[model samples]
Target: MAVAQKLQRCAVSQTGKHSASVIFLHGSGDTGQGLRAWVRDVLKQDLAFAHIRVIYPTAPPRPYTPMRGALSHVWFDRYKISADCSEHLESIDSMCTQLGTVMQEEVRAGVPKNRMIVGGFSMGGAMALHLACRYHPEVAGVFALSSFLNKDSVVYQAVQDRKGQPLPELFQCHGMADELVFHQWGEETGVQLRHAGMDASFRSIPGLNHQLSRMELEELRSWILKKLPLESSAQGQ
Candidate 1:
């Protein structure tokens, strides 16, 4: 069975007219409410966010393999921290199925699949990449902050199956000084993704560690605005 949790919504659209949506997942051990509080502050700083509906979905506490089966709020379970390590496919697929439902709900709620973006931090970012690159290619874009993929990820195989078809745009940002998820892993993921015909861009943040920065968030905001601009009808209102 898929693990589930109540998602938290932050309606940034001040005019009550949303034209786009961003579903952002939080890192391992963090809850949706925690990330929503932080991102809400940064997003509100930009007027463009006023038309975007942000969804933060919490991962239910599960037995994390890396932590010796200790419970953690992670999108999936992995045997280790290395990007080259073996993947826990069962857990990963279950989470993807759950996220797919979330996307479908957004579509049913009036947001087109092409106007939605999936992104996250750390483990959450990895899940975002898995969903956008493998499961939900129809999303507008995907951004991974301080995250990476397994060296032999199923995402690569899924892309190969497309036979040169295009997937959603991808923006990956990593801290050069990150010790947990190395910058090299993020760069390699981007390179492999491009090799597989994905529209992927990677940004290297010098002197950054395993966390996010204001500059990184600003860059992400710019990318989001470019990917999902306000519709003509909404702009004229």
Candidate 2:
């Protein structure tokens, strides 16, 4: 018997025939609907994304250790903020499985693995990075906004093992003034990825906070266009 599809709570948008897909995971304490609305507004002014399918998946609400065991939708359990940010391997692995399922569904629906982009904000972005590093079926790109990576040697080893697979182009945007994730952590994450032989681009936005800014979104749009160029016929249509 085929396994039942346990689809994560998500909000989806597909304008025309879906030639490409972008999965955007929401941050902790945020809903898929909220991220979907934000993405919709961002795409409204840019018609180039009309043919791209965007999905915002909500993380399952669970007890967060960093928040004193308060329940929230987080990608993984909070880890110590040391030089090597330790994470719960089990939690990270579970979320990666969940995200992989979502990606597989898109592939079954006719989208190619290379044409799909995976990204997220804050905690969600961190998970995206983790997922991309450890999983198979390379994606087109990965966007990590105001996020960091699991500095554990195990995580690095997983990435090293995937050296044979084509690494996805990574676009990391972080606010220099971010208090939650810390700007330093973002910078170090980029460096670490590069040292591991991944093509990672880290953009530092000065004076911004832990949240996404308009400038960051604009940069994201540009990055998307570079990865998945809009068809000429679709231009100005």
Candidate 3:
């Protein structure tokens, strides 16, 4: 495998002093710019996000195991796409390290781990779950759209290894009609997370598909605001 490209990041600068941050990873084969556009066109419609800095990170081009080793922009390589498939830990560990470094940089730049939320779509969401739960539990929150985890995900092991440490809250949303990643798998992921003692919440969207829906984004907005609210100083009071 050729050396993967360096991770790239595109950001939506906050209108006010950046009090909180949201690091959203794009799905496989997608770039940071694409997710950045989606955030600006859709999520930015809500004025409450004016003070929030949204960072969209792009994965480096690497050989994806599922696609006959074809190069794709993915956080990690996977042999299969099902929740029960075996995880590719070698690549997963590397990606987790990169993501961890990103969050640490955010902390040094002013946003504490407690004021940052990490999330993503599809494969990206899986990475978000790994980053928040396995790598950095101090994050404020996590959200995954149409995502899942393997039956023996290291996330479960990491949580169990912690032995009662507080974890970041997680919000998950899945479309009822999702075909690419089954809705049932998303539910199971939630169940497994909860069983592992994670503070996880799962939402089901009816008549939807593998893609995102406006309703889901609205719910995410509400969840984010609740998790990372502005303090008096950051609110420009």
Candidate 4:
């Protein structure tokens, strides 16, 4: 028997068949219910996806072995990202397992792989993208907001492991004024994604800071609507 992953998540939905599900994986220090506020504030306006579900997965407050046993519920073990991200391969492997498990559960929640999207901020963004590389059962989209791939990694291994297939639609949104993670880093990773022949849209939000803004959330909602199930769109509208 496989040990079920220990994670906390908050799910929001109104009523409808729901075309797609947007899973927001929060950063290390945040809780799953955190994004719930964002959804209620922004997504609730549409009324289209009254049944659209947004699932937020929370990282625990435990010690992160990725940082040499440091105390933090991180997606993967940290290894001084700027220098080299490949060194943390082992930790990334563990993180991938938990992520895959979470994804599996979501699929069973009525949203199949193709009708799903994965996204997050900072550490959460990196992990969301990592899952995108290995996306199976298919995925509608991926978003990495104000974050970068492990320092200088093309993520070739994970890409190759996807049976020589390609990644799903992906968007890499950066904040020009983000001081936490250099805007250039996100740009570079976007380049890498494009180089890999994936449909990646890299947008740097001018005058924005580290956190995702209301306008950004609206953009996400719009993107989802354009691609979400037509039935869902009709119901939402």
Best by lDDT: 3
Per-residue CA lDDT of candidate 4, range 91-134, in tens?
A: 66666677777778767876677878888887788888777676
Q: How do all models score by TM-score?
A: 0.91, 0.87, 0.92, 0.83
Q: Which ranges of candidate 1 are over 4 A from the true structure?
A: 1-14, 40-48
Query: Each model's C-alpha lDDT?
Result: 0.84, 0.77, 0.85, 0.70
Q: Compose the digit string of candidate 1's lDDT tens values, residues 111-226.
A: 99899999999899999988887888888999999988989998888877776675799999999999955788988988988888888899999999988777889899899989
lDDT of 3 by residue, 1-237 (tens): 565445689787777788788998888899988876765576555324756788888898989988999999998998887677789988888898888878877888898999999999988899999988888888999999989888889898887777578798889999999895478888999998888888889999999888777788888888988998877787663
Determine the backbone clash count of candidate 4: 3
The clash numbers for all candidates, in the given order, read 1, 0, 0, 3
Model 1 quality (TM-score): 0.91
Quick one: ranking by TM-score, best first? 3, 1, 2, 4
Report lDDT (Cα) of residue 103, candidate 2.
89
Q: Per-residue error at 199 for model 2, in Å? A: 0.5
lDDT of 1: 0.84
**Candidate 1: worst 10 consecutive residues by lDDT?**
6-15
